[model samples]
Target chain A: MTGVTARRRGRPPRAESGDTRDRILTAAREEFSERGYEKTSVRGIAKAAGVDSALVHHYFGTKEQVFEAAVEVAFAPALDAPDAVADGPLDEVGERLARFVLGVWENPTTRKPLLAIVRSAVNNETAAAVFRGLVVSQLLRRVAARLDLPDAELRVELAAAQLVGCAMLRYVIRVEPLASADLEAIIARVAPVVQGHLTGP
Target chain B: MTGVTARRRGRPPRAESGDTRDRILTAAREEFSERGYEKTSVRGIAKAAGVDSALVHHYFGTKEQVFEAAVEVAFAPALDAPDAVADGPLDEVGERLARFVLGVWENPTTRKPLLAIVRSAVNNETAAAVFRGLVVSQLLRRVAARLDLPDAELRVELAAAQLVGCAMLRYVIRVEPLASADLEAIIARVAPVVQGHLTGP
Candidate 1:
């Protein structure tokens, strides 16, 4: 333990590595948010994080990988739906899933990164590909496995589509009524629809 | 008629001006698609249309107006929802609406421009604002006026969100199963849920 602490001020294989990695990831997200994906560079991220450029590469590899990391974090809370499903009644899974997914967008912190990633994904084919591979599909697979139905993945995606679409209109596109509506009121209206998609015949 | 025929070449007077405007709009759309919103310019659209830059500005006023024209065209198909609602049985209004919106994406010509405008909206705030003010809200207001419910606009937007979200996955994000599923099959499954949002208890 002493040697681990003594060997480096900012090297790998110690508790500091975790802190350093998180610092770099946070910087990467902020850079992506402020400068966007096409303009934000590894060097810019390194500068923002106050670390050497080599260190960012050492931690997260390429710009694409770094963006993927941001998507991972952006999608983390919504990705927890399956675990929540594990504990709830099957019929009410829709409410739980809807509440969980919307809850991510409800919070200002997680929503900011999601906004950045969706914008990046929208404008860039490579970013879109990374987003396609990383977030929703990853969440869908876990969800489909838990759902245990014949057309499990399709059903889950339809449900996911409902939630994702609502968020886009409310948060991203900022359509009225839905945009300014009460969160629980939306949940009340939307949960049954989500439940229907997930469990209805 | 004789004076109209005698007008100078490429100078707008009557029939030619409509053709020229359409040409400029087509050129603007292609520029927005290939280069994106922030990068695409009035001069670029003029150049693509083989017209003078002054002509583009004279017709559309600014780059923002040009993008709005593109959004207007892209959303034209989905914008017909209110008309369909007027004719159809209210119980099946959801199916008609879903089929209308999704049908736009199903066509290659319409889908291409929708993709372009959405990508533009995602990357540029001006484009998003234009989109918000011009397209979906405009569609919702017309739709809400027809629905004749207590929370008509909110109900319309929720239904719109489902269709929009489903399109984003199937057409934009290209998620599997739902992405590859049959159109009618999707219509069958999604219509009921959309109907519930529209007119369900």
Candidate 2:
């Protein structure tokens, strides 16, 4: 199903170019989630998507490109999260940030891919570097700039560490007490520490 | 070798039972560090140690047991770290904990196996559960007990989250600036957040 049949016959296809690309990305996500970044292959993704390997390469130039695209698609919902915290008063920023992140993970649709990314990123070097770059530049630094506090960068990173650590424990590792604890309770307990990092004396 | 040459056919060996176990553990550490928990096998460890696979099975009941033993051996240096914080004044506990944990990671010798464990734990469910159990019950809970504060368990866990998150970024993920930052400076920036978790209003 390399589209060889469609191309040779010169027939109008049911799926357009955009649909094929989407299918490749969806397949890539599934592959990455199941096997992780290191073990995932372009050929595997292409086969899963019912396309030729060349087509996958055509849509995404490289494996890294496809992974980057996958990460972009997976994390799209939280791209605005830093701004969400930025618009709020300084004191309440921590709670808002916590809620936004936990809410993203708590959602059924979003959590699947994100869980894969977080789990895979930790084990794979390339994935970790990509994830680190996005988190630091896109999410953490942006919030740090808005705070205008001394050690602003460090402060925001520490806040991120808290929340990210919480996510790792609760969602990925499934650490108990924290994992099974009520969402609001965790927010109440964790927010103050984050706030301290952001604006404390 | 199966210790056949080292052991006598009719007499007791002089090296003692503990020496054999220690040798097995050392080999296990090397294998686990290089290949991680999932890929490392008892046979591989036995081959590396120049012992028969039966010897490994004899010394450690199973792969999980060997891994647990390896973790214990690897983390032995920092096993007392929580108590080190527990012995100090409440206000300074955060600094002590941060300094101790970071110091362990910053050292070349300790960081290797810990890195393997952290990286492997994220991608593998069994490893994650084992790691979660050890960190929570053995490390974090001991410190939480010393706090004697309300929600002390949750509080200590949150503190653990922040430090664990920082470790994930600085060591495993290699997030820049934070990764390259001076050790004491990070301690200065992170200690307060931990303090808040441990002693916040």
Candidate 3:
């Protein structure tokens, strides 16, 4: 029976290591970054990863799921931010949040996917819905829960707007001067304002 | 010959009465508000306006152009803002600017398109690019030119970020409390911050 099964198989089973998954993710990130989510397809990702299309589907059920995974991977640094904020002095929360968020944008490895999501969210409803869901559910909800204030939800949402808007101008739009300014300079100047929005009376 | 042609046309062959153009603009505004820029197509706008699809093409060659027209129509109030700022005392410029901007967002007629653009800009590259061009060239440049400060450009951009961020939270995301709060109260609270950004030391 084993011999018959081996004969029936077209080729030896490929290595089942997680390397293929990582490669697929990396390829997906690149493809999504270069071409927004709508333009990117599973076949494109598979071709980029040098893997079978079926393998891509086997690993990730749908393109949206793959896109979500890519976003999560890109936002991995941001995902760790809650722990970092928890570790730091409560007073320094605003500064830490600013630094962490800015750091993600400053890092090339993450910026591509971040930019892709931002660019896609502008024109694509599905992408916007997904992005909005991630922001509201994952990021804003946690930040809001951590805050000890009246209207905490509103405050957190506003704080997020401040940070996201700064990011939109500085990184996504690449507006002059703000775009070229030193990172620390920006962090120092903007953190207090964000802090004011977050915890201020 | 002109009279004969006019008679042959049945109606007086009115000089492209802006009624159709106005209807398309209105429909486009609603479509964009409800469906956003990417999902709302020319055909959809035409259908909504009860006009032939070809009329949409004849009126506006492309979706981008239509979007531009829609923005211009929607933001007619904002386009007057620079002149308003330029006409007023420089000292009150910040407060006036804030009032004008918040007022626009507070008005339902204007707020919808503004919200649509903000939401769309997040995901669409072309839309983002167009938004950046309009903001930088039309709005920020004008404001910067009016400022007597040393780093007028940076100041204008920063002030813009503050205002845009506030609007992003208050409207598009519908952050509670602030979203439902009095506009004058917000203007009073944040105008100074904007003032500081624009003219403060």
DockQ pick, better of 2 and 3 = 2
Single out the weakest 10-residue window by summed lDDT for candidate 3 chain A: A8-17
Residue-level lDDT for B161 in candidate 3: 72
The order of the candidates by TM-score, greatest first, is: 1, 2, 3
Q: Where is the poorest 10-residue window by lDDT in model 1 chain A?
A: A78-87
The residue-by-residue lDDT of candidate 2 on B1-201, one tens digit each, is 758865654455645666777888889888887777778899998888888899889888898888888888888877877678678798888888788778888999888878777766877787787787777788778888888876788887777788888988888887766788888888888888788788877
- Model 1: per-residue Cα lDDT over A103-164, one tens digit each: 88999988888878777876776877887787666666776777799998888889988998
Q: What is the C-alpha DockQ of each candidate?
A: 0.66, 0.59, 0.31
The 10 consecutive residues of candidate 3 chain B with the worst lDDT sum are: B8-17
User: Each model's TM-score, in the order given?
Assistant: 0.88, 0.88, 0.75
Error of 2 at B128 (Å): 1.9
Model 1: colliding residue pairs: none
TM-score of 2: 0.88
Per-residue CA lDDT of candidate 3, range A9-71, in tens? 644446444678889999998998777777789999999999999999999879988888888
Listing candidates in order, what is each one's chain A TM-score? 0.85, 0.89, 0.85
Whichever of 1 and 2 has more lDDT, that candidate is 1
Highest-scoring model, TM-score: 1
- Which candidate model has the greater TM-score, 2 or 3? 2
lDDT of 2 by residue, A100-149 (tens): 77888899877877866776777777888778777788888877888897
lDDT of 2: 0.82
Query: Candidate 3 lDDT, tens digit per residue, B95-163?
Result: 887887777888888878887777566656676677777767787788788996678988777777777
